[model samples]
Target: MSSVWHARCAGLMITSLALFAGTAWSATISHAAAPAAAHSAPAAAAAQPAAPTYQHTASYQAAEAKYNQIRALQVQAFDASECIRKKDCPSDESDMLRPLEQALVLKRALETAASAGDRDAAYFRAKVAAEESARFNEEADIYTGFQDPAYKRSAGLAYERAVRERDFAKNMLVAGAIDLHPWSCMLYADLNMAAQPGVNNRDAAFNAYYCAASGFADRGLKDLALKAYAGMLKTGHPQHPYVLDMHSRLLNVRPDNPWRKIEPSGLVRQPATTSKTSHH
Candidate 1:
């Protein structure tokens, strides 16, 4: 499909996902670690040549197709979210329903590709898992984790999925973060803040956000730096004593920043209003 189609699809996906507030999707990546060496490494190395790169495999092609689809779905989802923000969304339920249904189809395709050991598919799966993990965590908060049995069970499932997916997605993100990849740093921050079991580390979250913000600033991407700062604040880590010092640097960042002019409608919290009554 063309780039325009991809964008439209992504917008649709974003719109559908946004229906579940506090679960917005974001871009992310991961890096896998090197396997340990075998005992007879020298002999094995002499007997075998390196394997071919993925570009030469059919799995690569399949992954590329799924990747494009995922990107398109993400774009469409975002666009749908934008429509809702502008209050221009279609009132008809199907307008929203169809794209969501399409997302399921794409997800199945992604799974198929991943089962084939496609790298891109694995990455996409991890991204999807990360989003789900964050969503479940937010939902889990309402029931306070161990409070309600039914809610706990449901949330537990989500938590499990998120953890598995994050693990699947971590390698790439770690690699990218190390290289100071802005998106990677920000994504790593997001994954950390999901508050999933064994994944909740305020210090690490603080560092990832700080890395992203400082890196952006160094590259003169003031707008991105501001966004990163906002992420840091939103991640519930603002009170971390170690991160306290950076607050001053980003104190000026506001919910109305121009960098996110196209942000989703609910991205910023609106102030409460009071109704006044008059008696004659």
Candidate 2:
């Protein structure tokens, strides 16, 4: 579809995903050690001959038609989400469901009506994944390899594209008035599936702990936030800045903090509530 559609769809996608509160979608691409010998296959292929690039201009009309429909659905989904956010009650008539639920259900219908399993149908999903990945430096290089710096760059680009695409699709679904509540969950599902299983579980666990702490802090759920910080300390992350920053947020009111109660059990007591954290 048009650029306007692309932008609108993307806006909706981001709105839907952000609903998950403190949750995010992420993608990663890794560069591995190269083989001792250079990759000869690509070199040989390059030397053998050159092939013409297919523009697919001949298929533009069909692509545009599909793009336009997806675009419209995205708009619909966005509107539905607004209703859900404002606490409009669902009356249970055909017209009243959370936008997230509607978004997913609607998208499924679109997917069915369109060419089944068509690569085009996934265009927006791919874009969202790509964007989210780029934020953390992962990109996709579909035709490239981990061996080339260009491959890494391409991979990052692809991931960024995927993130953007996914966001847009979900947003569109939400706007269209589908089960909007689950849109974030759905986006997360896509994101987690695309994430690296993680070579560093220790880091991941601590990171999650701190992340939860941050959310609780924002929501004034200080007790829960402190407990989260304590949970991370239990994991013994060596108090890196990432970990310490989280603790610092608790120093004030810490004695009053729930975690400090464990001091009798030998947990390091957090300082008094009147105290403040300093960089020193």
Best by the lDDT measure: 1
TM-score of each: 0.39, 0.22
Residue 158 accuracy (lDDT) in model 2: 68
Candidate 2 lands at a TM-score of: 0.22
Off by over 4 Å in 2: 1-199, 234-238, 251-280
Candidate 1 on 53-132: residue-level lDDT in tens? 32334654665666567657766765676676665667444555567677778777876665554545554555665765
Kindly give the stretch of ten consecutive residues in candidate 1 with the minimal lDDT sum. Answer: 25-34
lDDT of 2 by residue, 124-216 (tens): 333333344544443354534568787777776666665565555544433212222222223333343354545334444455555556655
TM-score computed on alpha carbons, candidate 1: 0.39
